[model samples]
Target: MSTVPRYIREYVDVNVDFDKDGRMLPKTLIWEDGHRYEIDRIKAIQPAPALKAGGQGDRYTIVIKGHERYLFFEHNADYGDEKIGKWFVERKVAP
Candidate 1:
């Protein structure tokens, strides 16, 4: 049996800040269970596809609690804020 973990797109509520030049800077994210995680720093931002899941967006390389993770901003999803779009993380799910 293949032991590779399955990934699912898990949408989360994110707090963001915009610069004067309209650049987005993500501050923190709240999970479905109300757990919050602060983004320590952004390593890089680039347009990439979620290979684990199934989507495409600007992937943000962020560090949280000394661990790095990819945070995706799928610009097409209308999650109450059309101007900002929705944020998601490729979460590992059990098969």
Candidate 2:
């Protein structure tokens, strides 16, 4: 039997760039350890579904160091009564 790699969701700091259309594009990933990884290439982008109540989000699939990684950003309305944004990176573990 073969094993599938599992991705662990972790919040990370990211620098994003927006085009003339105001679309968010990831540029670099800043690790808490102070190591920075340039995005290099973007494989896919998926917009998060909007909730009937409010808050919306976006997800980007990126390639870094020849590995597939996911960068996610979301806005939550009720966390602090004020809208707040969250950023995260989903990293995969080899099996």
Candidate 3:
């Protein structure tokens, strides 16, 4: 019998913002195909060591540009698992 490798879920960073109280807010994450999804549910968040010296540590956000849209993500403070916030491109896509 042949075994198939399990596909791992991947996420990309978008943007990060601070509340008036300075608490990090939930981030967004878009699909590889530029589809938008909500991450209304979060589990936990923790600080992590820098992957490398002077690497700015692991608390940061990322932006990904897709053919049809742009995706945004950032470190979350509600989930132990890594996740990003996402939204659709400002412009509408053509059918």
Candidate 4:
């Protein structure tokens, strides 16, 4: 029998800094349980493709202060012409 990995993904609320080109960059992270973590440094910010065509928004991998875990952000397309996408976070775990 195989055991499932303990790491389950979670959606989180985040505060970030954006460039003039409107890129999503993480600055602060707030969990659903109300714990806040300020980003002391960004270890990496790689773009994950949302669609084959383009412009569906992006996904990012970031590391915050005091933790060696991988934090993710998914910025999705507009919901019903709202002119803004949604953001979500997921923590990665080693298998």
lDDT of 4 by residue, 1-95 (tens): 88554444466677878889986677877888999988776666666643322332355545565665455554444556753554555444665
**Number of backbone-clashing residue pairs for each candidate, in the order shown:** 0, 0, 14, 0
- Residue-level lDDT of model 3, residues 23-60, one tens digit each, is 56545554567765554433433444333211222332
Misplaced by over 4 Å in model 3 are 1-16, 48-95
**C-alpha positional error of residue 73 in candidate 1 after TM-score superposition, expressed in Å:** 0.0
Best by lDDT: 1
Model 2 bad stretches (over 4 Å): 1-8, 48-56, 78-84, 91-95
User: Per-residue error at 69 for model 1, in Å?
Assistant: 0.5
Give, for candidate 1, the lowest lDDT window spanning 10 residues: 76-85
| lDDT, candidate 1, 1-95, per-residue tens | 77889999999999999999988999998999999999999999999999999899999999999999999998956667657577999999997
lDDT for 50 in candidate 1 is: 93
TM-score of every candidate: 0.89, 0.65, 0.34, 0.59
Q: Any runs in candidate 1 off by more than 4 Å, and if so which?
A: 77-84
Please state every model's RMSD to the true fold in angstroms: 2.5, 6.0, 13.1, 5.6
